[model samples]
Target: MLKVYNTLSKKLEEFKPLEDNLVKIYVCGPTVYDYTHIGHARTYISFDVIVRYLKYKGYNVKYVVNITDIDDKIIRRARELGISPQELARKFEKEFFEDMEALGLLKADYYPRVTDHIEDIIKVVEKLIEKGYAYVVNGNVYYDVTKFPDYGKLSGQTLDQIKAGARIEPDLNKKHPADFALWKKAKEGEPYWNSPWGPGRPGWHIECTVMSMKYLGEQIDIHGGGTDLIFPHHENEIAQSEAYSGKKPFVKYWLHTGYLMIKGEKMSKSLGNIIPVKDFLSKYEPDVLRLLVLSAHYRSPINFTWEKAEQAKSSLERIKRTIERLRRIMTYEKLHIENLSLDEKEVYERVCELRRKFEEAMDEDFNTPKALAEIFEFISYINRKINENKVPGPLARYVHDVLMELLNVFGLLQKFEITGVSAEVKPFIELLVKIRDKARKRKDWETADYIRDELRKLGVILEDTPKGTIWRLSK
Candidate 1:
């Protein structure tokens, strides 16, 4: 049985979806106010692997991630850039997906934008007001946390503790300091939508609750984000959502990715240690970054340095080299089943055990660090068997499939494959693809088109889709 570390209960619980064999997941996406950084990748890639593992286990997963298109951050950033919030959000939203694509992440089922769901948000805010859980003063609506007796249950804080650390919002008209805004009245020149209480936009917390409800119903199987969101943001979401829907639990499993740190500090712009996702991708392969994130347990802080990235890169190359070795061996060394030696038989049995142990490690709270260790162990053993020429051709093929299957489950080695190109030249092909993408982005059509035509001659086909650009060797 699959298990997860639920932030809600603070326990490792067996995962059981609300509906049989169907998993509904809602991960809080980026704010889109600026370039998506590696910190964002830490959360996105963590959940991507989790969801992929669910699918690998035969569960039909519906994953939804929301884009905070309009918010205080977007507005402030836009003002500084002398552009409209919508324009700034649009630009970064495109760039954000580009970075995600470059990382080869599994696309979310529904990337609902908050700007697109203002009407739905307004309806929920209005209902909260009618239910006596929220109040409006001076055209700003605030959720009265005192009315919800179960407030802060997700963050494991009591009302007293909540008040003790209450955030100071601009609206002092709220009855309690723990109370949070449901809707913020429009500023003089900011974007606004028609609401029951004049013109305003939904607050940060309410948008996730409303969007998740609109897409996946009230009680979802998994609601996840970074651990930083466990407080105020997710805590406020729980309070306001349950208050509006009269639901006991707004989410079934609350999962949060551990913070991504750099130089013993969290990667934040204020600290001048932010590494943009694009910058990281340009420096390393997509799987290298995924390897770094999965090298540690999802709930453990990932302290990144150049040494860590280099370590992940080395490990990834080892994995790919092993897979390539198996592939190369498959074309020869045709030993019959009956002709197999005792050691060859043991290798086959070891391969089977590798799958079982991988599943076991993944089952226990999605323990990726252990799961990865299992993969590496298998790789090391199989490589030894290959060196001895003891692996049968069919066994070699089986090992290749098993390695690809397991690595793909971790969202690694899923992008470019070695078909027409040799293993040594694959990195060069990937580099060309990246360069062409950049050229296209810069509107250097002459260079972009030149690369595309040259690559076409070299049997590389670039397929552009809504998710992002992907390349393949033409069969």
Candidate 2:
């Protein structure tokens, strides 16, 4: 059975979906105000791997990640750029999807934008007001913290404790200092939608509650995001959602991934220390970045450093080289399964054990690092078997299949396959490489350089070794 660390229960719990065989998950997505950074990549890729493993384990999953197209950050940035807020949001939203696809993140089943769900937001707010859990102060509506006795249950803080840490809002009309806004009164020269209270827009926390509930239902199997959202963001979501639906539990499982830090400090825009995902992708292969993120436990902070990234790249290279060697052996070797050598039998048994161990690690709270260690061990064993010539053709093929199945579970190695290249093109690419090499031998510098540069533009990267020139697909 699979187990997950639920932030709400503060313990690892056996995973059981509220609905049989169908798992519904909602994760908070980007605000779409600017280019997405590495922190965004870390969180989304973590959840992507989780969903992949869940599907691999034979459970149907419906993943929803909402787009916060309407927010203070978007408005502020749009004004500074002299563009309409909608225009700016659309631009960044497009870029966000590009980055996600480039990183091989699984496409979210639903991407509910806040602007498109205004009616749902209004309906939830109306219910809260009718139920006496929310009030209209002037033109704004705020959820009364006192009305919900379990207000701080999610964050594990009392009302008094929350009041102490709360940032004092200028709206003294609130019933209590800890109460949060459900709808904010529209300011001058800002976008507004007509609501029961007046011309206004939904608050940050309320948009998620409405979108998640509207798309996935009232209580989802899992709700996840960065741990920084646990406090007021998620806490306020609990209060408003439970208050509206009168459901005791807003979500069945609350999974929070740890933060991404740089130089022992949390990565944030305010700190002016952010690395864009595009920059990382341009430098390192996408799977290398995925490995770097999955190297750490999902609930543990990942420190970003070039040294660690280089190590991850090397690890990926080892896997690639191993697979290449195994392919060559499978293509050339003859197999006698009935009379296997003792060494080949031992290596095959050990290879089968690695799959069991990989599943065990994944079952225990989705331990990706431990699971990856098993994969590395399998790679090492296969390499030794190949060197000793103890691997039969059938056994080598089985090992390759198992390795690929496990690697694809993490969404690695498969995405880098060169597309649009045909079987007939291989000999031509080799011919071009040979022609380029001959040009270099004859000292035809211009032709050789032009061919190399043109081939790069066609997504082929050429590497020169003392043995020969090797070519591979570029990211």
Candidate 3:
């Protein structure tokens, strides 16, 4: 069984979806006020792996990540850009999809935007108000925290604790300082929608509650986002959703990913240290970025730096070299001439052990770094056997199959397109290999060595066998 770290219980609980073999997940999506950064990439990529692994294990996953198009941040940004909020949200949503695609994140089952669900949001607000869980004052509607006995259960804060810690603002209409807004009155230059009380926009928390329930149902299997959103955001979502639905639990599992820090500081745009996903992906391959993010546990804070990225690139190249070398051995017909040996059995056992270790790590709260280490262990074993000339055909095929399966679970090795290498170069390398074979046959060591050195300079390596010479791309 897959075990997940549920933030609700603060424990690693075995994942049991509400429906058998089906997982309904709702991830709080980007606010769309600005470009997505590496911090955003880290969260989405981490969740993407979760979804991928669930599907890999034969669980049907319906992943829905909402787009918060109508919000205070979007309104403020639209005003700054001198454009309509819809136009602003549309532009940024396009950019967000492009970045996500580049990062190899699978498209979520539903991309429910808040603007499109205003009716549903209003319906929830109306229900809460009718049930005495919400009240309207001065054309603004707010959820009455006191009415909900379990208001702060998600955040582990009681009403008194929140009231004591909350910064008191000049809102005479609110019954208590701990109460949060469900709808904000429209200002002169702000975006507004028609509501029962007046023209206003849905509050941040209510939007998620309405949209998630509208799309996924009353209670979802998993609700996830950055750890920073646990307090006010997720806490409010739980309050409003359970109050409206009368459900004991609004979400079955709450998963939060840790933030990305740079040089011991949190990565934020206001700090001017934010790295956009597109900007980072331009210099490094998407798989390299995945490697870097997966190098750390999802629940642990990852420190971003150029050195870490470089190491990830190097690590990916090492895996690629092993893959290429294994491909060469798998396709060599003469290698099948000998009986599969005991070393081959050992290699198979090692591959199976690595697979088991990888699964164990992932099951332990998605410990991606430890799982990645296991993958590298398999790579090392395959390369050692290849170098030792003991890689039988069956063993080589087994390695390839196991590696692909593990990489698929992590969403790596999916982009196996031979990049930066021309198709014409392959024929040229093959011709050179044939010529080198002829020279070796004639005992022309000097000429063969010259050809080999030239090919090496051209980023090609030739392994000479008794039958012939095989060429592969050199790292």
* Top-lDDT structure, candidate number: 2
Sorting all predicted structures by lDDT, with the top scorer first, yields 2, 1, 3
List the candidates ranked by TM-score, beginning with the highest.
3, 2, 1
Which residue runs of candidate 2 sit more than 4 Å off their true CA positions?
Answer: 166-170, 331-339, 417-475
Q: Give lDDT tens digits, candidate 3, residues 289-382.
A: 8999899888899989999999999999888877877765675344342465687667767877998898888888788888998888778767
C-alpha lDDT of all candidate models, in order: 0.87, 0.88, 0.86
Q: In terms of TM-score, which candidate is strongest?
A: 3
lDDT of 1 by residue, 75-156 (tens): 9999999999999999999999999988888899999999899999998988998999999999999999889888878888
Q: Which scores higher on TM-score, 2 or 3?
A: 3
Q: Comparing candidate 1 with candidate 2, which one achieves the higher TM-score?
A: 2
Poorest stretch of ten by lDDT in candidate 2: 328-337
**In model 1, how large is the Cα lDDT of residue 342?**
91
- Estimated TM-score for each candidate: 0.87, 0.88, 0.92
RMSD of each: 10.9, 5.7, 3.1
Candidate 3 residue spans exceeding 4 A from truth: 166-170, 332-339, 419-453, 461-471
lDDT tens per residue, model 2, 336-367:
65577888888778878988999999998889
Runs of candidate 1 with Cα error greater than 4 angstroms are 331-339, 419-475
